[model samples]
Target chain A: MTVAIDRATGKRRGDRTPRPGLGRRLKNGYQRHWYAYAMIAPVVIVLGVLVLYPLAYGFYLTLTDADSLNSARTIGVNEIEATYKFVGLDNYADILWGETAYDRFWSHFLWTVVWTAACVTLHYCIGLGLALLLNQKLRGRTFYRLILVLPWAVPTFVTVFGWRFMLADSGIINSALEALHLPAPQWLEDTFWQRFAAIMVNTWCGVPFMMVSLLGGLQSIDSSLYEAAEMDGASAWQRFRHVTLPGLRAVSSTVVLLGVIWTFNQFAIIFLLFGNTAPDAQILVTWAYQLGFGQQPREFAQSAAYGILLLAVLIVFTSFYRRWLNRDEQQLAI
Target chain B: MTTTTVTPAAGPAAPDAAPTATGPRRRRGRGAALASHGVLTVASLIALFPIAWLVFLSLGPDKDDYLHPGRIWSKMTFENYSFVLSETNFWHWLQSSLVVSLGTTVIGVMVAATTGYAVSRMRFPGYRKLMWVLLLTQMFPIAVLIVPMYQILSELRLIDSYLGLVLVYCSTAVPYCAWLLKGYFDTIPFEIDEAGRVDGLSPFGTFFRLILPLARPGLAVAAFYSFITAFGEVAFASTFLLSDTKYTFAVGLQSFVSEHDAQRNLMAATAVLIAIPVSAFFYLVQRNLVTGLTAGGTKG
Candidate 1:
């Protein structure tokens, strides 16, 4: 009746019942939304104090030249005020274009690109192949899955250590290569092999997640689609290309984006595998980390700048990737 | 969408139609099956060999046996294990890891569960923005907050405290679990929520008494995720926890590097110990992991 009257009465509430007062509406809103507000209060408070606060503080740090020697410090009963002056865009400028910064940033940036692309390509290909094989009615499928997923099942720190041991200068891998008279490169020592080792170890750790997710995507595709394709005389390759690829687009898109961002910012593998010594092999995230924590007289502003730049790169990439994904959806619709 | 769990078994049965492809194709299917098995065997071996080698290395009595590489098979012993157990801060590290992990899991899952339930059941103000915010949180790397977090934690005198570590980890784990659990909650039918409201139950009561019990699997997945994340986290734990007793396995293992070559054997033994329980838990929850992740992924 109130809905009917409101519709008939020029969008006002029923004339017989006036709208609540401002205070009353406030009370009503609270009553209606308090449960939701209460439920979210814990997370809101925690994220607010911990995450958002630091995030804001980090942004502030990026605008100044804060460092260990200059930043304000509290020593016992004495206080030292921060003298690091504001330097907007200078840290970014230095890292992005300054002469010495060019070599440091660009070299690390190039390797990071190569590392991400190689690892993601390997992960997707190996994961998809294994997934396709497992999608068949094969014997010992569960056994194969259990074994293949072992690297991911183990903690990354532990598996990386395992890889470190195996790839050591006189480790088993080189020993095996030596016995066979093949080239046994210094995996941990040499630059090329160190980068290769990092990517290989990361791929080993990353593939299981991709495989499992893609397997789920494969499982969810209707058998009727396959039958229809078979009826149309599609070849095995045709069916895979047309039906399987399109069907996996949803899962693959998300996973690949995640793979790129993850590989770009991957800290544990590089850190655990090479520690801080392999400056040449360090990714941008680890390099930023080293600046802030690893070095003496920590350069907080520069570290924060590097972090902010990485975040910007990811945000821009994600938005573009999302737009591209949506366009693909539109093209499919057309 | 929720039934992806049951589809894996039904999915592979499509191969029954593959053999009858006509055009002189063999109905035997032996070649394809054999090739699949062969490839899988090779892959499985590739995956398993590294872990197996670690276990083997952990048994060496001499610290430098790994360097020599040939004497390990002849002289394997549990000396490294006993040594790591008795001659180090293994128990304290284990306690710290478990405490921090469990604390993060408990706090992370509880907060996220309520938020998940709220966002699932209600369209309160900022509901749409909440989802976007949760997604954005994932994009933030640890580098963004480490220095400021150090300052904040130190200001509050929480640098060497488990409370500080758990709080920092909660920042990482909560949003992720919330996204995952929200997706899980969506899979549960809304009619149950309605029925609880009709029975004179308040929203909180309905959520607790009805929805929470049914959401056990989702809650378990969230718990496992949070636990594993806090367990293996390196950056925050390494930075904040300065003292050895406060160190998790990640920081503790890092300290082993400067202790020289004998610690390699000890590190192997310790690595095995660290990996075992976490891996066991992973195997237990791997099935739900796919479901939880994709649920949050596709929907969010």
Candidate 2:
């Protein structure tokens, strides 16, 4: 088959003559690969318009003093008009240093980190624990797995809203607390409790993904490794530490990384829980959206700056993560 | 593929170890297994309790009954459901959600299928780079894009329109779906393409006739994912659509919650109604979903 294709290509080359025009060569190349280009054109066009353009425009917006009300206003120069002024790092400066009404950037930034770390750590521990339990030879494991994974399958908005109601002052949780003769703290009123509740809600929403993914990872481990370790008289804890942890390392890292990004950018649950009112519980994402659209003045540029900072943080984190993963992959290969 | 690495070792060791392993470990294993089961049962209940609570609240008599907590299950009623369905624009929201979600799914699946095929099968310049670009897009926070997207849509006069929302959803859905479909495509043997070529089919013809038929599972997985993403999306939908009648379920549900914060029964009823279709769809395609998602993660 290779020889036949080579011979056909050779004949086509011979038929094209010693020096084909550049246009002819271009046309031939197009003819050869037009179908491939055609297949990919819609995806490229749509993504370019909706994703790439917006991304570039967002960066541009970060450098200007655009707002919701005056977003359409422009200063006329000669024949052209510009809706926004070139503020040149003013938004970033205002958020990072200058005193403004939206000066909660630092606090929100810190909380975003704390929120992500707590959620990811709890999610990993709970998920891995559940997955390991499920991995054991138990009857009706499928039913248990399905029930555990139900949190993931349900729409997140529904679950988050349900949780809000459940944690309400007059709701089931406080009622249960009363039944137990225990005090139920305000879940969403106090700042500390609100942050704690947000983490809990996020953990509840995230654990299923981690559980399912880690379960897959656990299933893929060689049971013979366990037997080998057993033969060596290794304790169960030691075997799990040495064998199971290493086996799950790759999957755990991926799950944690993805979880970090998702939790950091989580908007709906927090938004629904606090509405447009909770300043104490706001993360960078909600803060950015509130700045851009939720508020009266609607500081578009400042919001874009917040977004740019988030993007930078994610990029830095991802690069470091990829480096660590690559090192692990190399070690595994050896 | 990694599963193959385990089988060879496990096959010989299992039978050899079974008899010897059972005697000593059985006693200890029983106790540990019981403990594990107990913990798992509690965990599962904790995981499911909120959803179960929602179901009860939705069924309970009225908002006051829900606030009373202990009075739940005292009397069952369907008045909340009837009220949500009849009194408000719940049906209108449902219809809007269906149209937007279906539109996103159809367009997303079509784009993913073709792009997946091209990237997997064709020898194109920068194809590898393109794949990485798609992956990177998944890491982007949607908040970053919302400002520019709002501006772009407003300029095009697509704000408050289904087409604009669908387009944004398609863009968001495309990157992951394309990568997933591409992973699926990679699993299919190239011999199928060779066979199609020998049978005198063009590249497009082979893709549409042979490759696509074999890749139906991939398409189904992508379609279902796209549908769910669009269906549950709140951020963009809330930002883009202004009118109550044009609101998707997620946005509409939020409005309902804000307007009736004290009315837990009605809120729960609406949440249950909104969740039923997605849960049903998820249950139907769960097997494919797990495999597809894991494959995309591990392989892509």
Candidate 3:
């Protein structure tokens, strides 16, 4: 084989080889890895043009008085020759501190946080509960698992639309409540009910992901630990708290972090459910979409500012999450 | 390894060796099993009820049945499905969705496979940083890119075009697909590459001819994921494709409700139609989907 011949001659050649110049060695390394560069070139180029350039242009647009009507014309023309006036953080200032608009920003921010927190908390609880239940040996567990996971398999647009129909004032849920002589809250009209419905629908859509993730984590817990805990006269709650909780910590944290990001930025459920017209239930994402696309004289720059702010917040959270994950991996390794 | 032992031990029918176990313990086990089954049944019902109701509404005779939940099955018919299929532009939207989704899948998988191979197997400067950049792309909100993506697409005269939509979808899908493929490629041994090199194959040739076949499962996972993503995406597709006939099923379905009021039956039928293919695809690849998703989350 050529490989055997090369190996045989390579060692002999290495023994008498003279050191190469820096340029020669660098060239050799480049030659050896040229294919790697070629392989990744397309991805780098496409992402650069599509993702990175737009990202930079978006940041630029944030600094200008761009709108839906003007953004295309402004950015379409040469960047340097664009007619849109640069506002230099005025959009940010207006959204953050301009008295009337400030309330909108803060309220949306608060709802975004609340929405993300409630959804992630409910998702984790419901999902972990389901995982725990399903972990027990039971008849038709596989079928139950499959059925429970169907929500996730269904497209989110469909699920949200379905939930919207179900939660309508005259829909099945209210009808069922009325049948039982219970008060039926107006789900879409009232702010509190609207937010509740949004979170409930999101949890319905999200819990399967959590359940499957936690199920995997639960399955990975060694059974011997449970046996040992039982031998020590640990109660069921104690075993769960001491053993199961600890075992699931890493996976739970990851799931929660991801859940926070997704829920914070979730647009479809709220958008399709309320048609992006429910002001009382607006989170940051839909609010941004409304600013940019929902109304005439759309505030593209302001919405871009909102997006940048959301990105900044997420970056901070993600860095902390990455740190926690790294620490968890280290602890596991040790 | 532990699953084999743990399953039977926790099962209702304990082994004969446990005959000395107390009767109360056995009864308690049975009760616990019954309780679990009860909970599972309720949870499954809750999870599936909305979809079942949607299907029922889709099959119901008219919009009036939607208001009266009790009458869901009173007058069932297949007219709604027929109406959506024949009266609406549903088939047109379906074609657009399929073409865009398949195009994205093909391109997304090809680029991801090659890029993943490079990142996984080759020793190159900036490869680690490239991987991090790819991961970061996954974290960035799609909303942030909406304005710029719109501008870029418009500039390229691709705003209403399938090619433009496919490109945007590929941009979103490629990062995750590449990461998934790279994780898969890492599992493959390097000795195969060395052996291919010994056989006088170039790096690209080895990757294409030798490594790609071995990574079919990973490629399948990536392709399915990309297809589902492109198929179900509404935010970008809705924005970029402004024409009604050009709309993907997601946008088209959304328009059915937004544009036309009191079309719940037809809307539900359309939703069911949109969901069927995705669900079937999911069924075929559910196992790989779980592994791919968890792997991306935990590892990437």
Best model per TM-score: 1
- The digit string of per-residue lDDT tens for model 3 on A213-287 reads 888888888888877765675555556777888888757765787788888878888888887658979888888
Error of 1 at A66 (Å): 1.0
Error of 3 at A39 (Å): 2.5
Q: Give the 10-residue window scoring lowest on summed lDDT in candidate 1 chain A.
A: A1-10
Off by over 4 Å in 2: A1-36, A73-83, A100-103, A332-334, B1-21
Best-performing candidate as measured by lDDT: 1
Question: What is the lDDT for B25 in model 3?
Answer: 52
Ordered from best to worst TM-score, the candidate numbers read 1, 2, 3
True contacts kept of 3: 0.45
Clashing pairs in 3: none
| CA lDDT of every candidate | 0.82, 0.79, 0.79
Could you tally the backbone clashes for each prediction? 0, 0, 0
